[model samples]
Target: MYEATDHPDDDVVAIGPADYPHVRQFVRPTRRALLLASVKERRDGGGEGSLYLLDAAHARRLLAPERPVELIPIPTAYRLDDLTFAVVQGLISADNALGADDRLLDAEEQGLEQHLQRERTVYAREAVPGLSQVGAAWLGSRFCSRHALRWLTKNGAPSALWSRAQIGEEVLPLLLFRQQHQFIDEFTKLAAGGDEQPGVVLCVPEDVVAASPLYQRILFFLALAWLEMRGLVTWVCGEPEYAKSDEFVLVPGEQAVIGTWMRAKDNIWSADVAVRKAQVRDFDLSVRHARAHSVTQGGSSHARLRAAVEYLGLEQTWGTLPRRCAELGAYGTVDMLQSRSRLIALDEVDRALRYVGGLGSA
Candidate 1:
């Protein structure tokens, strides 16, 4: 059983596995009323004692009814189950429930584990000079296909390196040092060194590398190359694509690869490029920044607190007072606090306001 942590200033609702199903049902645009009802009930004093209300009008606008669901293409179909989508959907649900706040370190870590496991398993099939041949074969059968092999051969051999390198030597170490995980640290170092790039910078956490699903990464990497070959991203790689045409929504990871290809001397377009370019876009750039910021911060404190007000109402929300307020007080990490106060814009709960404002203020 997961206990709801104290996070009064947050903007999202933290539900355990039991509350997930209830939350999931309201995951669509048409069901805004259902969510509104839930929030209304909370604001009017119902259910859990600990809660807060948000400005529903603002919440609706921030969520935007017309925004289509973002699709994150995992490397393998095995990873594309309801659970995976559920997690993504949960993260996107609402500012009160799944706002931009909250620590995604858990999700990022889970994704990393899945990535490493698949990477090791895939390379398990081939007859490595001194490795587990049977395991390698089983992994190959489970994840990789002949098509993947051909792409590895044709492209700059991303997969081939996995086959040849010893786990600890090159493969395992690199995975351990997730480039994304170290991104912020690296960013600080770069910034300190005064090396900021003017181009569209897609910053990912060093902890959460998009390489969990090798195929997904390959597809995106290759797609970027193809776009670059087509001269869409431009050689300098600073041009934004969303302004060009409404039809051409650049999916995540597409621009970077295209930028790379535009910079490449040989310009060998990988077949995986064809498979992945369709999923590329500019939204990912924002996601990358948001995600990194979220990881550093525990979650959106303002979103959480607002949710508390919406769900608990003024009187009932008071029950959440001590714990939630304290949790917000203890919020560790510079990023988590930033997400709460800076990103989500939550004002501290004034004790005088809580007492004097009475039930009306909540």
Candidate 2:
């Protein structure tokens, strides 16, 4: 049993476990409410609503603690299985209300529906092999790309412009550029203030720091943001330009060690050890700005590697490059990169590699 609270905004409702004695008979002992609490406490000092739709045990495990709960303001039941259906349907409804062309909207809606059906089939199985680890990484990337596309559309960007753009020749470089300037602007503000202590653990949830490879990627970005905020690393164009003096250590909260058969029993490493290892290498992280050309399977290994290296260099001084391309409608780039399975304009691979590589003129 549960209690429901209504807000002025009918779309947002709060439901929590009921305290009534009779409620125990209706609810199962193993069942728990899938609540989404804020990582950061509310500034108003008010408690968050305990609204939750029941989820399966497996689905519950996927609920990341660091994930900010975004309630979709729709009438449909918010279940994990129905999430895609709910969101896509909501988008379709909005488009219809706006008097958009039915033909264009119908085509896009059908494509989204098909993808959702495939995803549903995969998740419907009782136990998916390697889903907990490998699947999370793949799913996270897809989610990030989709979320970026949704962000653009919701913010009033025309979807058609980016949806039809070439991935390697247009989208990849633009995303890298957007991310670069975001870091630059943030770091500049921090540089104005004094530097902080070297060794500081980022304030992420314990589960987030140790969860999955996807969370690890998120943690990496968060740590990078923290480092940038302290002005610990230098930026040439839009990428972190490491210097000999630029050295710092970040420790994640609640350390745990897990071992695989591939490694020796005595060679176990904790989360902090990994973070330290990343720092020692001067954070020479790979840049995969787009899915289409970033992965080896999508393009020639040699070309992708060269492009990645060149992109890193460009980040240091190629600040305005992405902005220039974006002015010509790079908004739909994310959708094309993630949603489209087949690689496009493979012949442009060599040309794009040379073009991006040659852009390191600064």
Candidate 3:
């Protein structure tokens, strides 16, 4: 009842609802696989395809390992489940199913999904991919918690980084303006911009925030990205002992509040929408770049975009980000991502990130 057509520049493996449970089992451990699954019902039902980043080796290891599941293969990439397989494109190596091209710089040889792209250098990849919230916090902490603590105890992010607001105004992708064409350079512009764009204040649990500078940086960017919004994020098990070590003011928000998730309920909802909104921006950027990358080039940009989405943990926002990117113009937004479901104070929704963890981790 459903078709698994690959996105023009992306390497997708589409499945059905019956495959959900099977896929879900791999969600936590594998957050790096780009999967599309749905259940067509007797009524008007639709399927949702989320892109997950995969640890090619890890993903391959996690495969059924039975060998030769009966499925057709694609020319670009191969698909293998409990059934057959196919090769859709070039270089669908047997060892790394996700394909080994990490750190995709010139997507020119890869492919194109569009004519032009607002080029930008991503100084670094997503903060950390393929991990649970608590897991992310823990990883973040060991990654120079002392420095992160210094930032907090010192009263905030290095005034240099925090005071200089970056990102965007409508709380969107002002970060991708083609002129600058590099993340840090453009971010430098965002920071130097006179007025702060409206951004939601994200609150991660103190322990996790202190534990991870990358985690703190993510939240820091969130605060600097806000303009007209007054939102709050709550870390469920925040430890006040680390209060002095929690200097979020470094990110440039209006005010800082240290209440529990209970007091920040509305703020939590508002913040989730804010981040979901930004994810939309990132999604649009990826798709456009993918089109610009095209099939002639190897269609890698599309694949990379899908990976980036998973890396940033925006899987659920998949459907909205792509569609909104298309039908809506620069100013258009989505109604669905604005869910009222009491999301976590941090980006802690129980969904899979679908990307490999520790690609660049030391």
Candidate 4:
């Protein structure tokens, strides 16, 4: 085990195997020292986990061997929260860099409901597309909770989940997008080509038990998500069939505003309301009237059309789509329109209108 003290020169102490007989036999001396030090730090910190910076070699030694490992450095920041947020942002940015159409898929705009409905029919047939015989049996077993399936359908990429092997007694949740899968495959190929790849290792408190089935699953899912965000690893699965159409209407201007609004911590509701009013004024009276009528009559199509127009107007007016969409809770609509815009060849305005109309029909 590891011990720590206030001494600046001797902050960490490593205990040998004599003190802890059950310690894993294969752990090298240097890793043993690091592990002991980490344990001491955790103990001193009252069991709360601490993050450690592991080198690529150390990371490969410690992390699961089933996948290639690479270490990405966490930026030095004053606050832990800021550090965490930075990692999340980095993940999002990396995913976004894959290009708009190849980014992580959002369930709300991707016909997750329809996918689940289809899964129900497939479940009845005993022939789910992606599951191995062992995985199918495991899925058929009682341990797979309805609540877990419900959560996956509503919040995650269910196609990834359906496509993976689920063999063991304990099944971990898989949440990933199609582009992410491609990203991982490419990384794996590069690693296989003998490229010196770095990887990330998550350091946690020694006292923390990750052995419980539920806890392990949760931990696994979270770790996988974090890594996926960093473009490090992907959940093993077959290629997911996208249920949504490929056609997307591209907004010409800066799209950073959407991300900015998403990351904003301050209340911008009143400001958003004012901006939205200004946005509506850019539309013709007929469009404005239609929006008003839709608001009162619960006609979502007209409202969506107005939102699409407003989004385009916001794009034209330096970047206000974020605040407007956040205020209206129309992220799904905007995402749908943007996604459809990327798929087919149409002028901006015509594409936006057709997308809004198509969304209404869908």
Sliding window of 10 residues with minimal summed lDDT for model 2: 158-167
Per-residue CA lDDT of model 2 for 1-362, tens digit only, reads: 24444433453333323322333232333343232211122224577533324222322222234543333121112311221222223222322322323333234334433333221112221122323221222232232233223222121211001111111111221122223234323324332332331211112222322342331222133222223233333121221121112111111221111111111122111111122344423322211111222211213333332333343333332354323222212222221111111211222222232333333342
lDDT, model 1: 0.25
> Residue 328 lDDT in model 3?
21
Highest-scoring model, TM-score? 3
Give the TM-scores of the predictions, in the order they appear: 0.19, 0.19, 0.20, 0.19
Error of 4 at 328 (Å): 37
Error of 3 at 236 (Å): 26
What TM-score does candidate 4 reach? 0.19
RMSD of each: 21.1, 23.7, 21.8, 22.1
Query: Tens digit of lDDT per residue, candidate 1, span 148-245?
Result: 22222122212000011111111211111122113212322222322221111222222223223422222222222222222222111112331121
Please provide, for model 4 over 1-362, each residue's C-alpha lDDT reduced to its tens digit, 9 standing for 90 to 100. 23322222432223333423333333333331222223334434576644322222332243444643332222111112222222223223333332342232222224334433331212222223433332222222211222123322222121111111221111221212232233334334333333222222221121222232332322232333334333332222111221111111011121000101110123110011112333323322222232233211223333333332332222242143223222222212221112221221212222222332233234
lDDT of 3 by residue, 34-129 (tens): 332222221223454322122233333334445423321121122221000111010112113212222221232132222112121111114224
Q: Give the TM-score of candidate 2.
A: 0.19
